[model samples]
Target: MTETTPFGIDLELDETVAEGHYSNLAIISHSTSEFIIDFAAVLPGVQKARVKSRIILTPEHAKRLLRSLQENIVRYESNVGKIVIPVPSSPGDTGPKMGQA
Candidate 1:
């Protein structure tokens, strides 16, 4: 059974959607009206990476999403441990060198 929100929108999760996609890197670009987020998986030796998903949101909604992510990250770190981002050896260097268009 699904629960309805105060706005009367029923929230339901399908099996496929619940399984979800895995994205290691995210590319974010924005225009005056909206923000575009592209989720991708960059493998160690892969020549090219494909965008798994693209989500567009208004600037206001993007800011709200940022806040929500920050809150969740904080809670996650508290339960687990601090997440670490390793500094790359050089500028423009990640796991693999690939040209993305």
Candidate 2:
């Protein structure tokens, strides 16, 4: 087991990606040893429920989390077989990975 340090969290969220002038927004929060994330979005012609994404954890909990995720990934891979890695293209590749004009 690894020892943990007391750390703080800060979020730098930019809502510029949201469409038009209606942008949903939020701030990140945390306690001394745990971090939290709250994400929200507003839909057109609908009441916006305060959808939240909360993650609370210590350092040790983080390792256990990786283990759990890896376990599920292993199971998924066993069912789906090998997966392909996306090949990164070089410049002048004429792919959609390039920005729109």
Candidate 3:
């Protein structure tokens, strides 16, 4: 067997998406004895907030990953304010109606 890397990545996008500015989303899951990863993205300008990158690992790996993310979050919040989750839909504005444009 070939030497394996610690992490692997792949990407999938719509045919029309531009080559530049393409971001990757990775999803990871595991079975009884193996793990899986899937990378996907939502359409451009479409509910990007709902697209989440999932990472799955065994208990030990999960803990390690959590700690790593926590450290990064601390560093990030030190520079910027605490991250706040934004609410969907702009406030104080009605959405555009169909066939009006």
Best by lDDT: 1
Per residue, candidate 3 scores C-alpha lDDT tens digits across 1-101 of 23335575445455554343322445456677544544455454465433233335676676677699899999999999898854547575443221121
Alpha-carbon deviation at 19 in model 2, angstroms: 22
TM-score per prediction, in order, is 0.77, 0.38, 0.42
Of the candidates shown, which would achieve the greatest TM-score relative to the real structure? 1
Using alpha carbons, what is the TM-score of model 2? 0.38
- Candidate 1, which ten residues in sequence have the lowest lDDT sum? 92-101
After superposing candidate 3 on the true structure, give the runs of residues whose Cα lies further than 4 Å from its correct spot.
1-26, 32-37, 45-57, 90-101
| Ten-residue stretch with the least lDDT total in model 2 | 92-101
Against the correct fold, how does model 3 do in TM-score? 0.42
Select the stronger candidate by lDDT from 1 and 3.
Answer: 1
Worst 10 residues of 3 by lDDT: 92-101
In candidate 1, how many Å is residue 87 off?
A: 2.1
- Per-residue C-alpha lDDT of model 2 across residues 1-101, encoded as one tens digit per residue: 23334454454445553233322543455567764544555455566545444456775675586698789888989999966656757655432221111
